[model samples]
Target: MTETPQEQTAADGSVAMQAGRDVIVTNTTGLTLMEARQVAIDVFNANFIRLADEAASIASARADALREKFFDRLSRENPEGLQQAKDPGFQHAFYTAQKEQARTGDADLGDMLVDLLVDRTKHSERDIRQIVLDESLNTAPKLTNGQTAALSLIFLLRYTRNNSLLSHNALGEYFDKYVKPLASKLATSTASFQHLEFTGCGAVGAFQFLPEQSLENNYRGLFLKGFDPQEINDRDISIGLDRRVFMPCLNDAAKLQVSALNEESLESHLASLSIPGEDVTKIKGLFNATKMNHEEIRAKCVELRPYMETVFDAWSSSNMKNFTLTSVGIAIGHANIKRIIGEEFADLSIWIN
Candidate 1:
């Protein structure tokens, strides 16, 4: 039997179907040049419209979800403050957040905007808190999540301290739980710090002089704060001498307390500085003499070393040591940290005075 035109075209490597009087060609191999062009154009237009509609739908859903989150938080936390939504300042911030949320579709960014808008309802436009909130709403959207994370990490290292006894294990756990997730989102290049400076979130070179200060402060907060007196008491008991006699051990320990080293490595380094080939045992004795528990120190170091390495690598890779947050940066970074690590861990009280 002879094949029809459609069957002939199909056999010739062209897909064809009859739609009433029109021949709809999926493959234009058997069609004219103009027909092929028309098909290409139609396909492109159809796909383009489909993708555009999908994008719009996603953006609209995100905006709606953001509004829902905002009202939910406002109603629960500051029901009275909802009245301020009618005020110019609150409306401005709300709209800004909404516009940015639509453009970015970032839930974190939306949450931050919610925080700023909520905060605005609590303060007059003239208040510094409101002023900062206003500025933050403008600036926060310009930042990528990676840039915000970098800013927040720097802020935590510099401006905040642990309120309770600092433990290496706890520090490790904190970073693992709170920081590790964001760390993966960090940009591979140092441009994140540059972007932060350009956005007025921070100054790139401002912290150069105080490069080691954050690390030192962190080290002291983690290992030295309440442990010093305990070490002194332990030394006195072990050596059967006055606590004053073991003060030098505390002093030596302080000198040897390099922020970059874990306890075992630090002790080994300390021993190396002394008589040649000295074992870590002598270093352990030194810590023991100070009444510091060597075993506990080693255990803490075991837990903390990996976390320290991870943080230090991030800092070095991002050139974070050279970056210092401006007041705007501090506010945004504080908010970012609270978002990531929760409010209980995001203490900024030292900046209050």
Candidate 2:
């Protein structure tokens, strides 16, 4: 299941709620009921804009408390009284459904938000969120202030639904179908220049450079195992000499070899990428945020802290090879990644076996 968006403080002290499952955001401070409603409406409208045209019908058909609140008491109590409502069929169906649902004593609008936010994306998380964004935006012109805030809260619900589906659906499938097998192949390979196929991660064309930080598993013997001390040393030397050594030399003759090495090693190991077709020239631009100067690195890390942490957590939870290889290794990798960034990267070892 997807998680919910959390309320967080924006620079302006306005509560900003991201419309997704990973975090829920809201701030009830500084605003009248009407202004909150307007923000909420704007949010939902923006969400709807992210969807396809077909989702408009679904949005129109949805039973929202926002709309119901606009209705007089007679509309809520008399089925025929709502006949003149914009969507009589839908309203009637909603009334019927709610009537039955009320039997469970959970007919509140909060409970119905799930249905209101259905993504109808044929089960894809991207499609779901896109649908919500699209449809919510489509309904923007018709809402009032209070209705807007209420709708924003409702859109927040949609964001959660879509995020959960995306993580568990798209990402889950990606790891199962590609990351696992490729990481396994690389792990077991004897070649000095190991290659991982990136068919599933959506990368295109020839060999590409991946940052070491991008790697879900520790690049050190990530796939291969059971090597003696001599073998480990040999592998390290081979990695340095065969791959890391020449990365930056291709770009600038005078560039320090160490700088290139850091960029190349970090990109290759962390990003799970490599030079495409002997074009080591691309290594010049490789970015391993951690290997940069402390000031630059810290700034980048702080800006990207949330996303990086999330990625690390998800990656660690999925990568299994390293964790299975040795408890000591897992512990070390976990502590290392967390110290460098945060716990997000620790669980990537879980999915690598």
Candidate 3:
């Protein structure tokens, strides 16, 4: 559900694009540059908070449901074991099952499960609400009031819907219309970016991109510009962020495959598509970088070809379709992380800014 660089526009007359279901137009045309930038930041913050809250709420509900189902199953299946301490086998089996179930949940789920195990019925929406509220409060130091409000709006837009946010077009459009303005400001603000290093952002776009980092405890600040990624002890090195992108040639190839009437025909059609060597190389490098096995990547390419082709067809017919990443005026952050790991134990939170 991630939006490729081709699927976004700046909305500041810097770029005017309609990506899928969302339309991003230039909104900074009339206002002073400063006003335009502030407006963009406000919109971004609003969208961010909204998305964050939605993610928290969805995560909370899912975690609670899982906890209830698991404990209920455990209670029913191991009714007699709780009263006795002698059945180590039953205890081990129960715990093993619990562990497996817990694997399906993420960080928020883990927190919810601990609360549920402590007191099942006592856990409620209020508990999750409080956690989310606390998270917001903690993040407040990193954002302006306007930015916070913008984030809250974005969260509500996604959360109220019952369906999954699978449509990249819709998410992209929302960003273009509402979030792009703010993104411009944030991107331009050295201070905001620096502060955001510690204050993780809410999820946005189809990929649910969050500013959270893996190196939570190792955060310091940005190193010297253009520092090498190989020295882990160097104070200047930073952990790289993971930004997923869907390739253009692969996308085109996918389209060709889908329109074919049969698997054989699809393969034939795909074979005929003239994908560029650079794009193919980029795609291969992307797959390798993500640690995807060659066979799996090939299979994925085949499976995804059809939908991607449809996307391309739609894009070709309108302004929305004519977009490319370079045209979007947004710089996608890409870093070679293995090289980074060799160089630094430092957190990459600074890069989020």
lDDT (10s digit) by residue, model 3, range 1-353: 88676654455445333433322233323433333223323322222223366665664354345445534433554433222211222222223223422334443323323222222222123444323333332233334533332332233222222122223344344334433333322222334333333355422223331111100111101100111222212322122211122222222332111121122332343345544444434333333232323333233323433332332232223222111111001101111111112222122222221
Each model's TM-score? 0.60, 0.19, 0.20
**Ten contiguous residues minimizing lDDT sum, candidate 2:** 192-201
Q: State the C-alpha lDDT per candidate.
A: 0.56, 0.29, 0.29
Candidate 3 whole-model C-alpha lDDT, 0 to 1: 0.29
The true-versus-predicted C-alpha distance at residue 51 of model 3, in Å, is: 36
Residue 308 error for model 1, in Å? 3.1
Q: Model 2 Cα displacement at 95 (Å)?
A: 2.9
Worst window of 10 by summed lDDT in candidate 3: 215-224
Number of clashing pairs per prediction, in order = 2, 64, 30
lDDT of 1 by residue, 26-122 (tens): 3313444333333423332232223377787775566567667777776776676655543445555666676678778888988777766666667
Superposed model 3: Cα runs more than 4 Å off: 1-129, 138-142, 145-175, 187-190, 197-255, 259-353
Model 1 lowest lDDT segment of ten: 242-251
The local distance difference test score of model 2 is 0.29
**Model 2 CA deviation exceeding 4 Å by range:** 1-85, 88-93, 107-231, 234-237, 241-353
Q: Per-residue lDDT for 199-233 in model 2, tens only?
A: 11111233322222332122211211121223224
